[model samples]
Target: MSCSCSSSTNTQNELHASIMQKINNHPCYSQDAHQHYARIHVAVAPACNIQCNYCNRKYDCSNESRPGVTSYKLSPEEAVKKVLHVGGLIQQLSVVGIAGPGDGLANPKQTFETFSLLKKYAPDIKLCLSTNGLMIHKHIDEIAKYNIEHVTVTLNSVDETGEIGSKIYPWVFYEHKKHRGVEGAKLLLEKQLLGIQMLVERGILVKVNSVLIPGVNDEHLPFVARKVKELGVFIQNVMPIISKPEYGTKFGLDGVPSATHKQLMKAQEACDVNVKLMRHCRQCRADAVGLLGEDRSDEFFKESFADKSFEELAHHYDLNQRMKTHENIETWRRALRAANGKINQEEATNKDELSSNGNTMLVAVTTRGNGLINDHFGSAKEFLIYEAGDKAIKFIMHRKVENSYCMGKENCNGTYPIEEIKNALSDCHLLLTQKIGDCPQKELESIHLTCDESFADEPIEISVLKGVRKHFFTAS
Candidate 1:
């Protein structure tokens, strides 16, 4: 009996270790892995079978980089060659993926062919595929055969009734016919959930990517997160809808703004109860390369950045260096103040009414750069201040502060000098960040400062406006 018990325990331990090994190197699914591992995507698949109201795959020379924009497309053979070259150069490359310029499974021949070459050339490397989930069910056999371990299904909504789905996805081409409106969305959702279930049953790790559309699926994504969690998805990445009028998608042409940071956080707060929300994804392009948060595709492909050494490339996109407080701190402050003054000039319209009611507020956002609330309160080196009222919001200044919290051991009994940090933010009414600790939360409250950590990677202007509206006007 003792021997049998020991054997059982050993077996369980080994199984747990195996699972951890599978996820420890996947940057998209494992947030911790992002610090060390790099992933490269090959845009071998360009034919999408479904029409998302937000997607328009037009390639141009524009310096802008986002999902659905791949400057170069390669066949399976060409893709394998590029992968080999990149792999040889970047030693940390652990995972190779096929995300689209279109759905991976939609162009099955090219998709699987790329996988086949990858397995042959670099069998040790992890294989991942991202699909819209419309045709994922059809390729399960090949997926398993290639030992594809991670799969991402873009499931915007799980509404079987199509009430919300019809608005997000206008049409899907499935089987031999085209599906439109609510019927199309219903069909896509069915297949998406079914595909996820099949992958789970096959012992494959699944991640669900849901684009948080402002009015259409923003509220619905948390529910989708809950449902996918039930279907055995390992994590959920709720991305903001990146809309541009030039792309000419219905949502963009109608001027639907991207999901602001606050909105994503609000939705994530709900989803957190049911599923683990992924906050580290860069919403990478199909041909994206290098570290998860930073895109080095241009350096690798576009000759403008020029220096192609892996170390030099990584240094070029380093966040700590990018977020460093400029040496001439006063000059930086002056520039920020001048920019705010111009914005204040245009926004002086409805300020009197809001100011009279004490609704005009100063918001301090913890960010890393590029107008995103991408830092944690405990890790923040400076806070970007913005003045927000009923009608307008503008960047005002950057306040430098020490990270007083999260410096000591959690269980250790010690004094935390939160007041030192509080003094810098005393004029601000609210604080926004990716996350905060309970002790710090209570400390901020003691000073009558509202600390909100629900938001991440949001534009400073939009985040300030939304934070003011949600925290100030909602109760009134």
Candidate 2:
């Protein structure tokens, strides 16, 4: 069923109450609350079902301050811990979100588990989920059941582009199989729009995040805005495309430059005619912490790990060493917490320099959550892209390769084409992974891609900042 909004019988106060009750404190949905309140995203959903050419989910989503990155992924229990811990520290933290290092609904078990736990621990905090909207139809009932106040669904294109109207997404996994090209894009768009319609019918606030890929979807977004508005989306967030050659997205590799601020504003202005435009978005990460105006994810990570080294905590979450996907890390965490209390007590005396600014270099990190550089280069299915400037580093996108060479049983007989690797990461200046073989390493180097194995034990922000300074700035 499509959204059927009515206003004839509704009073102005009734309308205001409905809107405020849902978005009064949601920073992303409400512009007024952005400065006054804080929101934290727990990266509990590490799996994704769709593949966007523009994303490499290997780095924290705080890229140069854009969103779609997280320092690490967490189990639902750990997510609850981080929320409670950060909530105690940041009094203004009014919202807890599961936004993905991947699609939130794609990992419903993890997303709902985290949400259920939050109800028990931090009931007052608003619950939010950000999904690609492929699985939204299947999960809409659960979303309403859980009282998820806000949902952000990314709608890249609605006007059909022949085979695949939306060049933004390449494939989607639905009904347990993969659908590619136009069919996949069509299926995704159908579900996304239908899901938004369902949410609106449920009286849930919906925000549409349309990535303005100029020359690709820029001309197509106004159509999207009108369609989504008809479906009852409360606001439309027209975000700029951060495409760069070094980041290696299909669009980036094809030499698609990021949309300028002027172009972005223009797109928002055009879309605003149909829907309420969200101009105050920061594009926060899936595991973002702190207020909407100020991100404290790095600071929170440092404080959380003050007692234990990243390497020590890595043992619990290393996908290579673990038998169960979500093995109980509580015992391991308890031991670490005992050790950290004393260490953090001493370290708390000195201020941590977890600033976000640094030289603006796009760096990709290989990780399997747990907030550490743990994934090997060849086996990595996702690469989290970040933009690191002198003062701060923020996550931007997640690049999902169809298949990693090392994931198959084949040896390095050049099975992974050098061109494919080059195309995937032509825009990135640095690649951070726990390990890389000589062949892939050399192939990447041939394309002017620098590799860093030294960041294996560091937090994402620290590693990227240090690497950017040492690798790019020191030479300058």
Candidate 3:
């Protein structure tokens, strides 16, 4: 009963009809769908039963951007209204869900209440819920009752001996009893697996989110991936653990280092499961708004729209306009896919372009996907990593950015983590994007990296091949 994926990447063309329909516009589930769709999370759940070594929930932490952190926690009533207001403004907004400042299932009353109201009001927007999986077995019937088609379970480890889980999660509270050590770990694992199976049986799409913690569960995730895939799980997202010292979590305080881009890719490559690896995750905040990696929660506070009714905000939701916008996006995407197909024919020729006596280096590309260098450097959330040289031009993997260089006019102060971006691309020789401001261009140049915008609308592989030759093959 496993999906028929020939490779690790999931393509709309290869997806089954049922799976495709569920992920067509869900940003979290589909790699391609994310480029054109938007999603939002309402922080209605504020209780958790299990304590992880890497978590320290910060309610009203406006500066730090990560899961278990939110600027405000809204009641079920306020949450439904926020959805209506945001859905009207962002025509591309397709999914609304509750991902926590705490575990959603732990606060079942608030979680289901939010679902009931959103179901009653904004039926067109798909419903998503993320939880710890400790309570899912207890409430699968109610979840089915609400018709929640999408669910995310955070299953960090799959070690049956509970050794790996003991390192990641310290304790668990179930059925009014607190358990610690290996016992707690085993109980949590059993519940998570059972709940995931129940969800699959009910025909619900399940996405397993596992944090890649170094020395803790990094070596154990391959087993986790295989187990979930065997259990009819839809997809598996392997995310890097964020353990900043300021977050005050156990790992952060104990000086456990955060996973680097290279380490994450290595773990992902090591897994090699048929289940798709999600490379676009930004490790979004619990109450995140707007597209991936971009948080605009501050823009739509309760005080900002306290007087607006659901009907008043709902009036602005334009189905016709959304349809038109999506149509335009689809047209360009189709062209992009056609162009990228050239890789099959052109790749054979490029493999030995400079094989005998040429230098090889890594190059980073910024694109919104259409086989074109169309995304601006400051706005790109990911850099498509590729290996290029006289020998060949091949895509290796993608690297995700924690933040974008540009937010907007009022917030664009030219000091948006330029150094961080530089470090992320340090090994690469060149960066290709639609455009970049002089400030970043100069910063990147200081690291001996060249930035080019000349191939703004050109096909990615062809442009990359040419750019590599022009810099390394030609006489200066």
Candidate 4:
């Protein structure tokens, strides 16, 4: 349950140093940034034996997908091609994570094949994988063989009977039998701890992601943290439980999310360890592609996979295209955007409907970033808004250029006036812009609009309409 770190002039040392430097210096990991969008996750696993109440295999952590949402399932070879295609387009391929709508280990054949192919084709790519840790103990050798540097296991509680704990995973097929309740929890925990010990012993970094649920495991997180740190885990990411009320879980009832930043911070302070908090972590989609804070759904569609039809890709991956919901469209959009690809507006209709009718959509778009779209938008001097029924309106008054800002000259194509932009959105049912902070709240409320903060451009969405709310804002 302990690990030793010694500095040496070995290749591993150099590699670790390089990776660490990249993480620390990268814009995606910057402390001041409100969102981090550097990593990409691919859900190659389609089935899981164990389940947690807080998790719905139907959807991803970001709530971008529901269980059985996608119709695409690529073979490892196809996945590798897709990674290469995406990596080539994205600047910092910081981490390639294999998380799941199901357990990664449960799909060992696909998981390992994907990892092996990534190593073969994108060796320099930093590797990451998330699991429930039920089958991690069995895959330590394979994980190490691929030189995986980071691994995350979702551990909500230690003791099965403790507060903040639930026997959510009723049963798991272990040796082909249903192991339920405490037995399943114990089995999962045992494998988790063993996996942590093995990874640390082998010099691989470990991170434990605990979803803090109030009255459930909120009180028990300190125990989880202390235990993980003792096992030489480097970071403890205490994530808030994302509850979906429509999914019929006790957790998401009352429309309130579990825990708060303040509560999680308090727990971290109490844990009293060298564990670092992953504040910018985005519980991304299984097939998410983007930098740390930005979403590139549009880019992914336009660029990386533009040649591949959505239906064809879905069928190839064995995704259920027929039952594919609005969630699937968003997931596709997000993936495309991450890859700097362009999404055909005409084809995005079905996906657009997945969004709520009254939902306000804000797109913090700029052409100035150090990416491919620099030429698409002429200058970074003006911001533009494309409403559903109106022509693209330009905000000339808000023009100002800044340096090193993700939405600025080096990072974005340009800037634009805020007031002028708002005026243009006045007639639209919803306003989608690079940001809305500069816009007057009275203007947004006047339009009966709500906002989607996940547009990757705007950092905040304050509704002027009393009681109306905005959800999922990702600050750049």
Candidate 5:
């Protein structure tokens, strides 16, 4: 009995190690890789087969970053040309994906052709496919044929009754026809379930993207997480819906509000224990061309790279150099883990003292992700929140700031979304950031939230522990 259990444990460990190795440099799939690697999505598939109330495919909408919005569409040949050109320029370019201004599987020919061209030209770069999963079951073999290993399926509901799904997806075009209402929802759900299972069966890493639609399917996402975990999903990204009316979606036009930072937290908190939750998702554009948070699509629009041939562009790819850079990144990541472990150990040592009298508080931090208080206030797109005091300093959840306060002073002139940011962090007791301007700082304090800048660039866990000890435990 002991030997059997030991063998099973060893198998699980080996499987986990293999998965980790594959995702070690995949930006969207791994939190550790997110800061170091880059991913690009080509908008070659211009036709979508399903309709979601929240999605409005807009072309040349460069101001916003969201799924189904692209500056320009590319052909299979143009996509490969751009990939080679960008891969040459961006050493960290790890995964080439087709996330769409439309559905990936819907335009199967263009989707697979791009992957095929990349395989023939730049085999070292990885391939990824993101789709609605309505037709994913049918394309699993094709997905595997091109050596594509990473797949993302946006699955919002697992309610067998399709009651929850109906509110989100009004229709799904499958089998040469459009199915509507509950029937469409049921069909879409069935396909997503089967496709996810098949993708797992073939040993492809699967990431499920479920949009947090506040009133519609927000309460039902914990169940979605549980179902996806059962389907052997490698990771899950619970992205908040971007329903601003200017984007021109049905939900937006009807005035359906987007999910607040708190509502998103409530949903993710319930699901993260069951499956790894991706809080760092930028909900990237179809033509997004850089690191997760940055967009560089404009630089590579067709004409700029039209003259660069495969060999000329491939020469600069240099996978060996990329691997070396990734090794250095891993070294940094390992050191970060060790430092965090030490902080946690020290916090544990003082756990009894901390619990004796300190007032527990929720502290928010700004980070660029190597476990440091690095990002600045008014510029942070997201905040790393933590529960510090009494118990161990624990990461609660990351809250997304809908709009940045300001990028530069010239851009700030009464336009920094300071009010929005303040409302997002209203419940927090303290905000830890690299720096903050006096105006926003004073406004934040009005809500009883204090800003601390003394621990800038320090290890986040260490800073959180000291802050809690100083403010809540020791007398001023």
Candidate 6:
């Protein structure tokens, strides 16, 4: 029983200037939006000690813990009724993270009893947490006695002098042996830079999620953004290593970094400093919640743990009673083949030959600016088509604007001409644009030389391409 925060330097600099103006008006860091989607992670502590080969505590290790992944383990009165049923169906619940299947201070009694029942029932909820500072210097007084205001620390390398943080976090259990490589990444980067300099000298706002990993720590992300901006760490989320070949893990088994928009704006201009690089991170889970890319986890699993009706939990998981039809593309391909099963028969026959060839698949879904598409016929609207083979096509563009062109840049008016996105892929010979650029993939392969071999060069994990097109082409 210890959680208190109110030093009130004008209410912690107006809550760190309204969370750095919502992380510079997020769309996952301003691609003006194309799905960096978030909606509170909801698996409380399954278990994790430390072993990051690109994580696999069975699939809940927002930091560590792996095995068949399904630790609901709920109760702080079932997580404050799933955070007021996901804060009345989300607009900005902002953040309430634990970041686990494990390690919210290594599940400190279900992470401080779910942040003391969301500060005694959702006290204007906004408490983000993520850890790997191996039990964050013994729960910095239960995360400043629960005034917990956003802390992410997955410091891939503060000192394990590379080789991908010594082949992904070699081992760290501390005082109980199991300390390998750069002696357990220099004792977990010296207790995560002494819990990020005691949560930025107790102002309580720090972010540093570095996972980069191309040739391991892409030259150590500007030395991990100049050592978490000399421990003041306002933000630095350099993520991109979610390597999963069914969790064998050598860090997402090479070849995921297509890294364009001029290589993530030249690694955010070579991490010049003054931290802040979170570009709308969907490296989420550990009870994630809405308003970055919007998931609202089935309206917080039907108003906090099912009273029923997402068509009665999709007819009790027979799943696909038109997936309760709303965010369609067959309701995001039947909720990504029921949360990761199968759906990529060349993106379900390029959405059935663009709906048997009437040809209209325009999705623009913007969050804004440095989130990258870099103009390719950009008035963005078409919306439906999915049959990636009989002449190749997979269009799902949706951005008429609903908040995140880095949070409405003076109503973002600009984009569309690589010739109007190759004249909307000129009645498709092949085109599957889920955010592409390298100068619009050499101007859409010089106008359709099979539009970069029918997409999926990357960024199509909408639940492992709907579980590899529902267990190999819509259940045969």
Best by lDDT: 5
lDDT by residue (130-246, candidate 4, tens digit) is 787878788899999988777878887778552233344556577788777777667767777887888889877777888777766777778887788778777777766667687
Q: At residue 313, what lDDT does model 5 achieve?
A: 67
What is the lDDT for 422 in model 5?
A: 80
Looking at candidate 4, the ten consecutive residues that score lowest on lDDT are 389-398
Writing each residue's lDDT as its tens digit, candidate 1 over 168-284 gives 777889987899998998898888888999999998989888898988887777789779879988888888788878667789999998776567656766676787667666777
Candidate 1 TM-score to native? 0.65
Could you tell me which 10 consecutive residues in candidate 2 have the lowest summed lDDT?
342-351
* Model with the higher TM-score, candidate 1 or 5: 5
lDDT of 6 by residue, 52-78 (tens): 877655532333222223334454456
Q: Write down the lDDT of every candidate, Cα atoms only.
A: 0.74, 0.71, 0.81, 0.53, 0.84, 0.51
Give a tens-digit lDDT track for model 2, residues 1-476.
12334453356669778888668667787654554467888888888998887776767444445555777768887777777666655655678888888888988898898888777656678898898888889998889888997998988888554353546667788999998888888888788878988899988889889998878888878898899888988888888887777666778898888886557646865776687777657677667776554467887664574354333443322333232211233344344335323221111111132233323667888875434677888787667766665444655445555457575655555457446556777778999999988888888888788999987755555677678778876754
Decoy 5 TM-score against native: 0.90
Q: By lDDT, is 1 or 3 better?
A: 3
Task: Give lDDT: candidate 2, residue 240.
Answer: 83
Ranking by TM-score: 5, 3, 1, 2, 4, 6
TM-score, candidate number 3: 0.84
The TM-scores of all predictions, comma-separated, are 0.65, 0.62, 0.84, 0.59, 0.90, 0.32
- Stronger candidate by lDDT (3 vs 4): 3
Clashes of 3: 1
Reference-based lDDT, residue 93, model 1? 71
